[model samples]
Target: MEDGLLSLKWNNHKITFFEILRVLREKANYTDATIAVEGKFYPVHKLVMSTCSEYFSEIFERTPCKSPVIVLKDVRSQDMDALLDYMYLGEVNVNQNDLASLLKTAECLRIKGLAVPDEDPTKFRKGQSDDRRESPPPKRRRHEDSSSQPLSQRPVSPTISASSKTTPPSRTPPLQHQTSSLPVSQSQDSVHDSIVDPPPMVKVEMEEADDPDDGYSRRDNSYDGGSVNEGDGDFGTELSKSEHDPDNYGSGSFPGPSIQPGGDLPWDEGDSSSFPPEGFSGDLPAGQQPQGAEGLELGWLGGNEAFRCHLCTVSCGSSTQLQRHVMTHTGEKPFSCHYCSHRTARKYNLKIHLRDVHGVPIDRRFARY
Candidate 1:
């Protein structure tokens, strides 16, 4: 839907229906099949891609290569599950308020590289010369130092080693370095007053030291060779005992209803505060159990609400989608690939991706970026 609501007072400014229709009809974006999924149709009066999302259609059209399989051999199934989430929702929503690992399955799966700004190459790396960029050449140096120099005593062209009219001999003697240091009292106070170490010299070096460990902790630096908490005595015994102790009062009780501990059943939705115990016998109902236990019991919902990925023997939240994804490996070429860098998953998208990114001819329908 068009987010803009066109409004105006009739006597103040009345908009004609024809003008509205003209704007809707004449907009180049009204051309068919840009935003809608293929084999699906859209209303001519429907707002254009740009009317709602500026780059939506452009990103959709990008193309990649034609590798029929996505071999994420090294990735875990749980991470693959998250990637599957994007297939259905088009984006992943992650928890930000708590400490939970944001897991994205590393897909050697030739399906598609994430097509978004956060994943772009330029963003992943920063500019090389940003370090060398000079700060606005000290403001005081511009306004104070040069201007404050004594006008009467400053270097002048009239002071000559030899007069210009008398041409020196061809064999001129090499001039000695004769730049006499200016007296401290006569020196520009602004320069001397401002001369101090720049923060960047130290800051840049420190940043360079941290560059290697952005991804990995090669050595145990969290607890450096010395103690982690130097001043405080090591109360490892008490800290460990408290940190690992489970809150026993929070367990074995059901919410608003009597539930067999560890029993696999639906908890009463009416109340969810009191949860079951950790060592309790039966599988507790999901809601009445621990707050975080619900996600791990993931089931694949598929064709006829079946919860199994028959092709992969895996489970997904949506069975139909899972089925369709499995077909990608059968050389269906549902997404065309442009064979420049790597393969793309969808055929039509490859055309758009190639045109926008590589400036390549769209004739080869399989290319993807």
Candidate 2:
């Protein structure tokens, strides 16, 4: 244990020392010698120069001079500067033109670790130049040529030309094709058939034969059970026994088949009066009632046909619509103005109030409504 060897390591010591030497060389500090190249004197450290180059080491060893000013003949100042940088920092940057001169100077100075250039330095350079000249140029692509030209100046492609030159297929008109495919007689017959087509007839089947003079219909008899007599004649009964019965009409006056005003009954035929009134009694048939708050009659909306509001008798197209309608009667202010206590049953109405009363910008979400 007493004779054991110890090794301490500083990984960056080489680089750090090089950096210090470089700084010292730049400042001309601790330089014990001078290197004169091309009439330019560079202060240099003998120890550093001798350590890097054997020629300098031999000169120093032979002369035993403390501080010698070495005169370098046939060497460039720029080359000397590069060599000095190499000696200090272990790296030198020389371009292709100056690299040959730098290498020659380095060889003459016997600078260690400086790579020697090839005997014929131009061979590789000549080969590179020749390769660049001899290598085939990239083939001109069709698309590249077309793209290089202005769009209007570009030549029309063969595909486009062929398409342009080629004529489109001639096609028969639909009516002509249909008619031509059939025989001439058949074509005329079809035309005649279309022109002579009969109007659709809706036959009204009844349990008893009806007299046009009497206003009674199957609908009236369906609701009034005791009014129609059993002796009523159907199409299957004897013609002689098919007698008109006045008692067949309800005991109460016939009432002339009263039609509720402002009712959208099937028989109303889009009459202006059929459009619902402001607040009409919806005491109408199932298919005749007005929708929304105008109709407060819920009895006809039963039988799962229409959605009737519980809060009011207004029938809606759907449950969601009915829920919205019920809000009116319930006075539910589901939507409220953020700026004030004003509230509304509908989002559209709220938007209107905000725009008209509050002067607030309508939210983008409510803009559509």
**Best-fitting candidate, measured by TM-score?**
2
The candidate scoring highest on lDDT is: 2
- For model 1, residues 155-243, the per-residue Cα lDDT tens digits are 11001121112111221221211213212121112122222223222111101111121111112111001100010111111111222
lDDT of 2 by residue, 226-293 (tens): 11111111211111111211111101100011122333221122211111111222222333224432
> What value does the lDDT take at residue 326 in candidate 2?
31
Collision count for each candidate, in order: 48, 0
Q: For each candidate, what TM-score against the reference?
A: 0.16, 0.31
Candidate 1 minimal-lDDT segment of 10 residues: 222-231
User: Which ten contiguous residues of candidate 2 have the minimum total lDDT?
Assistant: 154-163
